[model samples]
Target: MFPYAAELIAYAAGAALLTAVGGRGLLLISGLGVAATLGVVGPLLARALRGAAAAPQPAPALT
Candidate 1:
């Protein structure tokens, strides 16, 4: 939910800036979008992977 909010804010801000500045703002908006996405996704991915690694595995079946 927080990540989604961050994404929404970033997109809204980027869109606003792009609309106001046209082509010149694109690079900045693109950089911001990437940074925001990474900021949100990196931690989520790390946490998910950590959780998965920590979860218990099932025992193997007998041959």
Candidate 2:
């Protein structure tokens, strides 16, 4: 399951990069790919960062 998800992410990233590199003519597909990649990754990164930030800080030991 994780492998498949990673593959999908790879595919999207590749598509976005390809579109960015030399696909100015195909604006529609390139634009869509970029949007799709952002849509998928943006929220996941945000959630991960938020979770990291929300992790409980260790309490100081009283002397």
Q: Please report the candidate that would top lDDT against the real structure.
A: 1
Model 1 residue 56 distance off true place after TM-score fit, in angstroms: 0.8
Estimate the TM-score of every prediction.
0.61, 0.50
TM-score of 2: 0.50
lDDT of 2 by residue, 1-63 (tens): 999999999889768767776556456666888999999999999999999999999999999
Error of 2 at 10 (Å): 13
Query: Model 1, stretches more than 4 Å misplaced?
Result: 1-22
lDDT tens digits by residue: candidate 1, 1-63: 999999999899878878888876788777888999999999999999999999999999999
Q: Specify the poorest-scoring 10-residue window by lDDT in model 2.
A: 21-30
For each of the candidates, give the backbone clash count.
0, 0
Cα lDDT over the full model 1: 0.91
